[model samples]
Target: MSSKVSLLISIILHAGVAFAQGPAFERTPLFILEKNRNPENIMVIYTQLDSECRVQKKRGGSEKVVFDFYWLMKRKDFKQVNPIIKKEIRSRLELLPSNDTHSFSVMMNDLKELDTDIKDFKLIVTANKKKGNCVTESILKLGESDQNKKVKLESIYAESKGFLIPTVISVTVNGIDAETGAKVTRKYMKK
Candidate 1:
């Protein structure tokens, strides 16, 4: 009996390497706006995905695949004022305001002139290899501000260098308010 078929092929190769080492999928949190409550006006975003690369395609035959994700981001914010909720949260985050009651006092004086440490924002992603055609990138480093009331953005950092064959790195967090642009809390990271 060939030693029970070599112990059933070594127990099916150790159960397929324990299911390929498991744990590598489950990320959700891709918002542009929609969460609010008010905690000195809130905003916290954090993300980190290093060295991930992937590519696959069958073309017109079906079974599609195409993903390119490189990531990094640590953005924070807190603002409280009211100039009509800081002109509708700077027109829905498009920012760019030099008037209108100084737009939350120039974004809470640029989060009190940042530099408490942790600073560097940049994240690039391109998807279509399944998983809802993802697309998210927004980690501004407070390069401009001056319309006042009360604003706070506490963190920022992002980096990437992994592309060409196996990608899946995602992290997301959100909280915004200058008065009422909404979205006060959000989180996502699992992969």
Candidate 2:
């Protein structure tokens, strides 16, 4: 084949591959759960989780979660906090030394309400132990509801270090939030 024709063929093939892969998403809503055994006092679980987005209104759908957590010990120095979502620290629950297993549930909804599209967001859980800190993270994603009759939901686990118990982070394409300045606000659970 002529060099010109070969070049044209190569370009066509590359274009086809690129188109088949679909648009690049900045933050994907998939997560893989990671089990950390270093700090053994904390456990986190997600219940009643859901996410949706309304493109026409430029408003994101309600992203809600039932955050069930358990702290295995109670001490004067023991600290358990969700710093990202909860800004203020209140009455100490661990003022007195006790062996009681402390557990509580956090219900946070309306996490990703933005003028632009949000692919997904992450919920982080961290537990403070005398030995070290252990972290658990979960991610939520929203898809086209009307277009796809059945909205697919699945769970994947990932490992990362950062943040303390019951924290949330909203993720969007850089372009989307640049102009709108819209962000997700976290609701703290009543103590």
Per-residue lDDT tens digits of candidate 2, residues 1-191? 56643442343223211111111211112111112323333222222211221111112542222232222222112224366312321121111222212212221232234222323333222122222321122222233432212111122122223555523223221111112333322221221
Scanning candidate 1 in windows of ten residues, the lowest lDDT window is 15-24
Per-model clash counts, in order, read 37, 7
TM-score, candidate number 1: 0.20
- Candidates in order, TM-scores: namely 0.20, 0.19
lDDT of 1 by residue, 96-190 (tens): 22222101111212222223221322122222222423222222221223222121222221111244321212223232333544433322222
What are the Cα lDDT values of the candidates?
Answer: 0.25, 0.23
Best by lDDT: 1
> Stretches of candidate 2 above 4 Å error?
1-43, 46-67, 70-108, 115-152, 155-191
Candidate 1 lDDT for residue 47? 21
